[model samples]
Structures are given as C-alpha cells and as structure tokens.
Target: MPTPVILEDLQAAFPGWCIWRSSAGRLWATRNGRHLSQHEVDHGLCRTIDADDVAQLAEQLKEQETAEQAL
Candidate 1:
C-alpha cells in the first residue's frame, strides 16, 4: 500500500472511488456508488501502477468512464 498521503490524493481526484493497494502492493480502485472495479472502466483492463503516476491514472480512469458511456 502507498502512504496515506498518496491514498488521500487519489480519493480526492477520483471522488467516488475506493482507491487503495493490495497486501502485495498492487494498486486497486473500485467505484463506490456502483460495485465496479477500475477494470470495468477500462473494459476489463487493470494494471499495477506507481503511486507517483496517480494524476495520470486519474485522467485515464476519467477518460475510460467517458468512453464507456459513449458506447
């Protein structure tokens, strides 16, 4: 898991998502209102990413949501 600071930043950027990491240090994020994993946003794709890339991750997730909605 990342430090509390990183987790907080991710939560703020992705307001309705439960973003965290696994015991093995793999990143995981799931939507709150809907029981959906981050993978669902990207058409069942999920990847482990660096904490420092949270901002880029947030943008990707947002874009995924927009793309899904358009489908």
Candidate 2:
C-alpha cells in the first residue's frame, strides 16, 4: 500500500489555508475564531481549508489543466 496521508501533509500541500493566523498562533475554522485576510481568502487562500475544500481544489486544478492543454 502507499504511504498514508496525514493532516500536516494536507496542510503543506494546501498552503492556501496556511495564511490564517490565530491569536494563539494556530489555524482557525471561522472568521470570528481568527481574523482572516480578505485578500488571501479571495485569492483562494483563506486558511479555512477543509477536506471537501481540498477535494474541490483538486477538481478545479484538474479542470484548469485540462482547459490549458486544450488551448
């Protein structure tokens, strides 16, 4: 079997979610929990990344690649 995936691995792979800063120096799940930069979030790096978000991002990347190749 392949190496198992972990949360840190997901976090590293998706640095977009790393932009969030908590008062306690940790990640957050919502805006009230921590102040997230509007820019990063709009830029697709809000740091509120969840598993579903990751999967969606992967799908988007795949679609973008397919479109680029078709171009």
The candidate maximizing TM-score is: 1
Q: Work out the TM-score per prediction.
A: 0.51, 0.31
Clashing pairs in 1: none
lDDT tens string, model 2, 1-71? 12214445434543433423356644333222546456544545332432234344444433433443454
CA RMSD for every model? 6.4, 9.3
Candidate 2 ranges beyond 4 A from true positions: 1-52
Candidate 1: C-alpha lDDT: 0.57
State the C-alpha lDDT per candidate: 0.57, 0.40
Estimate, for each residue in 1-71, the C-alpha lDDT of model 1 and write its tens digit: 23234667767766766777677766666666565466564574333323335555666566545655765
Alpha-carbon shift of residue 42 in model 2 (angstroms): 21
Q: Count the backbone clashes (under 3 Å) in each candidate.
A: 0, 1
